[model samples]
Target: MKVAVVKYNAGNIFSVVHALKRMGVEPLLTDSEVELRSADRVIFPGQGEASNAMNYLRERGLDRVIPSLTQPVLGICIGQQLMCRHSEEGDTDCLGIFDAEVKRFQPVKHEDKIPHMGWNSIQNCQIQNSKSSLFKGLDGEFVYFVHSFYVPVCKETAAVTNYIHPFSAAMQKDNFFATQFHPEKSGEVGQQILRNFLEL
Candidate 1:
């Protein structure tokens, strides 16, 4: 199976590639439209500012290619944020795969950090009387997260995690699946999630 990891200006692509390698899949890291479109599965993983990433995608014409993909596509961290309709990070418009908005986390208390980093457990939202395939065999599992902006719990939300408040830990809409956390850094559970995505 051909798995393609999208190459963009954002960081953390290498770690995602390493995770897939551990899963026994050598994925292609490419920005080429042909390579991305032909792949069995596409992984759009990134860590960076929203507007900057969007600019890169648009410049490379991936902004147009990504949403049209027929195969299963996974977006991680900032990649997930960019998949939403809009983001407050830079007052940016996004790909709109999931009809949701990304907003900056406002800390109500002193202990509540701006960037909700580190390990947090996600509760599967159980969409349509069943858990999402992304969370298959993994319920109430802790995943590594590092971000300040979050998509609020919405119709597309597949899992929820609370820090300052309840937010989308993971989301799914048709062939598109996304995670606000870093699955590559989430240990065994993360690997399982990647494996599930690959198998799908």
Candidate 2:
């Protein structure tokens, strides 16, 4: 399959690339509208400040291109945050691919952390359908997550996880799919998620 990973100023791009290679898919990394549009599937993965990432996407016209993709598109980490309507980080407006908002974590207790790093189990929330689910065969599975910000339990939520509180670990809306966690770094569980995404 012609898998394309969106190229932008974000971390974890190489990790995502390597993960795909492990699955035997040589993914094309590009920011070109034509290349992205022609791909059978596309993945947008990143780790960065929301404002800076939004600025990068806007400059490359990817802000417009990404939202308009007709094929299955997956967003990871900050990529998921960017796909939401707005982000509390830098008080920025985002791509609006999902009708959601990204908010900074407000630590309430002693154990509550700023960046909720490490593995956390996920509960499959209301998935849109079986055909495009990334959580298929996943039951209380632990995936890698490293983020300070989180999207709340929204209509588009496909999976839920708790750290400071319950948050949307994975989300989907039509052809768009996203994960707040880094599935690429989640080991076997991560690989399974990628395999499920590839099948779609």
Candidate 3:
């Protein structure tokens, strides 16, 4: 199957590339509209500021091409945030695939961290649709996260994780699936989640 990893001016692309390679799939990393649209599956993963990433997507005209994809598309981290309606990170409007909003983490306590980095287990994970879940029936499984912003529990939310509070760990809307955590860096469970997405 042809899997295209949508390339943009964002970080953490290579890690996703390497992860797919380990699964025996050499993903096509490109910003080309033709390459992205024609692919069997697309993985839009990134790590960066929201506005900058959206601007880059806009400049390349991928901002529109992405939401139009018929095949299954997975968004990770900033990619997931960009799929939401809007983000507080840069006071930016996003792709609007999911009816969600990204908000910055506000620490209420001294121990509450801004970035909310490191491993955390996901809870309330269940099947949102007929497709296999991004959580892979691993509700209590820990995944790696590194972000200051999060999507609150909403209709599209498939899983929730508690850091400073409950937030979306995984979300699904039709063929569009997303994760706020870095599945590529989450070890065994993370790999299973990727496998689940590939299977879908």
Candidate 4:
């Protein structure tokens, strides 16, 4: 199957590619509309600022092309934030595929770090018997996360993680799936999540 890792002005692109390679799938990293649209599955993974990333996407016309995609699309970290309706990072408007808003984490205590970094356990929030494909067979698993902004618990939330508060660890809406954590760096559990996305 053809998997495209979106190439843009964002960090961690190679890491995602490496993860897929470990899964025995060589993915194409491209900004070309044709290459992206033609792929069987698209992975929009990034580690960067919100507005800068959005600017790059808009400049390349990906902002318009991404939301219209019919195939499965997975957004990671900043990729997930940009997929939301809006973001508090740069007061930016993003691709409204998930109908959610990304907000900066407001630390209320000393331990509540601004950038909630490192590994954290993710709880399956899907209703009884209706589990998310992303979390299939993996429950209460720890995933690596490195971000200061988060999407609050919402209807689209597929998984939740607690740090400063309960926030969206992963989200799913139709063919679009997203995770605020870095699945590429989440070890075995991360590998499973990426494998699940590929199999979808």
Best by lDDT: 1
TM-score of each: 0.98, 0.97, 0.96, 0.97
**For candidate 3, lDDT tens digit of each residue in 1-200?**
99999999899999999999999998999999999989988999989999999999999898899999999999999999999999998899999999999999999999998799999998878645443366655778889999999999998988889988899998888899999999999998999999988987
Q: Relative to the unseen true structure, what is the C-alpha lDDT of residue 182 in candidate 2, on a scale of 0 to 100?
A: 91
Sliding window of 10 residues with minimal summed lDDT for model 2: 124-133
Sort the predicted structures by TM-score, highest score first: 1, 4, 2, 3
Candidate 2 structure quality by residue, lDDT tens digits, 112-133: 8779999999986457545336
Candidate 1, residues 1-200, lDDT tens digits: the string is 99999999999889999999988899999999999999999999989999999999999999999999999999999989999999999999999999999999998999998799999999965566688998888888899999989999999998999998899999999999999999999999999899989888
Model 3: clashing residue pairs? none
**Judged by lDDT relative to the true structure, which candidate is superior, 1 or 4?**
1
User: Who wins the TM-score comparison?
Assistant: 1
Clashing pairs in 2: none
Candidate lDDT values, in order: 0.93, 0.92, 0.91, 0.92
Query: Model 1, stretches more than 4 Å misplaced?
Result: none
- Using TM-score as the measure, name the better of candidate 3 and candidate 4: 4
Looking at candidate 4, the ten consecutive residues that score lowest on lDDT are 124-133
Q: Write the per-residue lDDT of candidate 4 for residues 2-83, one digit (tens) a residue.
A: 9999999998899999999999899999999999999999999999999999999999999999999989999999999999
Ten contiguous residues minimizing lDDT sum, candidate 1: 123-132
